[model samples]
Target: MSDEKESVVGASLISEDRNGVRTLTLHRPQRKNAIDRALWVALRDALDAAGHDPAVRVLVITGAGGAFCSGADIAEPDPTHPVDKMRRLTDVALLLHELPIPTIAKVNGVAVGAGWNLALGCDLVVATPESRFSQIFARRGLSVDLGGSWLLPKLVGLQQAKRLALLTEMIDAEQARALNLVTWVVPESEVDEFVLELAARLVAGPPVALAQTKALLNEGADRTLRDALASEARAQAVNFATADAAEAFAAFAEKRDPEFTGRWSVSGRAVPL
Candidate 1:
């Protein structure tokens, strides 16, 4: 594996800062951090590191200067070879969804085209008040790519997702919040701090329970009612076996703060308590 520091130096999409948060900053700030080949490779590596790194409790993806991302750089591709281009770009969003760690999209300004789906791929989204968004592929004579078609419907239901996808109009943060497009909308100055606070909280929480919750939620979404209930029971089975679960209840009984001892490792072994 490349040294983390060295990787950071070369990466354009994925960058790590002081906090435990792994930031995937869209590097094309001039073109609103539009996606490119190097950015995609760097992003995959960054996300892979964070997924396996125990230190990272949260992953934040945002734009550099203003806009979060403007999606793929159409100018880079030759119009004569349109084959497999959409699938390749869509893989980035898939990578986002497949990340093991909790992910958040900090939309500072606008997210267009695949950029919008990139935000959607994260587990949650928090946008600045000034942020605006649109699924603009249609406006460019292209249909939505990546997870937009599937994610939008799941996020805001069929009707609203249709309206947004079909019209390809801009939706401000306020409108996004009202439509359940984002978790929160704060001032631009507060976006970083707010996201940090959330990351810290996750870091401090019981790693076992937090990971279990995230896993269960992601998997539970696709299960049938009976299957989902079974999945929940299975999760609880694992959850109940954790030291954190025992510590949590014991602390409650003693009316003292729980000092959790659990590792986020996929390994079932508990941390030495």
Candidate 2:
């Protein structure tokens, strides 16, 4: 890697791209990638950059050295305190949920507490064999404060969410994948390679279509069937005008390799206004 690349690699939470798929990694493995105020700010900035940059097609979030994220730093009391940073964490978590660009979490290792919730916020997650998840707040004499309470129910049904949240049991990778909490499970050694391969495939796909597709699904999550249809219609209509759409169909007709111009608006809505 070049000097710039090396510096980026040294991040506490990193954002970098290969084949148009940008990855944001949590880099506090010595602390098991523990979450802190500074790290949260860095994460928000990275996501903001990735969302706004046209060259970025998909985003993958994982850990740097030993973990995905161990959750909030318990070394400090009050996971969110002094009000400001508390609010920021909440905001950033929601922003990731609504990201227009496809957001993925590669759970390469232990993901506990807010760490596990962060993984849930992503649209998809691919995990390594050694990956494990825990919602240990109850054990810490606390309530589920992150997006966990909300996102989990949407994912694994109310009963399962209650079991995971209240019991605070540690679940392994295979169990997580079985629950649809993860998209794939691979050997620890293959996690990086598999994630990159999927990212490349997404990058080669039509950018505008993908963004709108994600947006539609997000809106449909809460809307009634009729309302969802209306939402989809609106989103599809907007994509019809994008240059990427025309290029996709043209390339299909000619049966040739098509160059994609990843020109799509990364609306501030993706970052929670």
Candidate 3:
């Protein structure tokens, strides 16, 4: 019950930390939670902070007022050059992709263009059954950005990815799940509770192992089988060095659920990146 809610950057984004889960809500309901530059900075910084904070084990991103992000906010004037603006977006994408702790996207409604990629960047995406998703980049006469080109092809295969990005066809959450784009498709009314329960389960697991598993999965597609095996072995070695591993064994022996403290420090300190 030590949850605390904080405003990270203006009312556009709301941050809530409960138990071991940090939920970042896109709050621009008027704009269907469209992401502006300020929201992007807030989200990137929030992800970085959560990754470094030992108290945080899972991060969830969702939109307020029943809608996930519609896309990038086009209403604002951009003083920066187009290249600089895109570079900034790229940085945010990379930061979200590389965050150590697990991230979940709770897509309650529409997620289009960069917004769709935002949800894709997360380790898991739980969406409402009626939620709509689209690349929507081609429709706007713009190619995909926010790592969509990279993430889509991997998730849905090259041809399906091309179909989605090229046609910009809107798909329901169920279709997204079938396409391997969404992990779960819950009813809109139950999405929040379902995501909260899921986050709790994730946070209750060994943090080091979860992080390592996430890293392995993310890099698995790009690595040779041999390289992946070596990486997995190294990760297991690190896991064995943690008190959490010992506790897991002891709990198993005692026939009790393990109480994971999630303090996988190296020599009584944080792991070096």
- Encode model 3's per-residue lDDT on 1-273: one tens digit a residue: 667666665658899889889999999999999888888778777777887888888999989887899999877776878887887788889989988899999998899999999999998999887799999888878999999999999998999999999899999988899999999888878887899899999988998888888999999999999999999999987887787777787798899999877565445534323
State every prediction's TM-score relative to the real structure: 0.87, 0.89, 0.94
Model 2: residues >4 Å from true position, as ranges? 1-6, 9-11, 77-82, 262-273
Clash list (residue pairs), candidate 1: 28-33
lDDT per residue as tens, model 2, 25-76:
7888799999877787787777777778787778888887878999888785
**Which one wins on lDDT?**
3
Lowest-lDDT window of 10 residues in candidate 1?
1-10
Top candidate on TM-score is 3
Rank list by lDDT: 3, 2, 1
Give the higher-lDDT candidate: 1 or 2: 2
Taking every candidate in turn, the Cα RMSD to the unseen true structure, in Å, is 4.3, 5.5, 3.6
Candidate scoring better on lDDT of 1 and 3 = 3
- Model 1 C-alpha lDDT per residue in residues 66-182, reported as the tens digit of each score: 889888777776454455565566566766787767888989888888888889888889998889899998888888887888889888999999899899999899998898888
Shift in Å, residue 269, candidate 1: 15
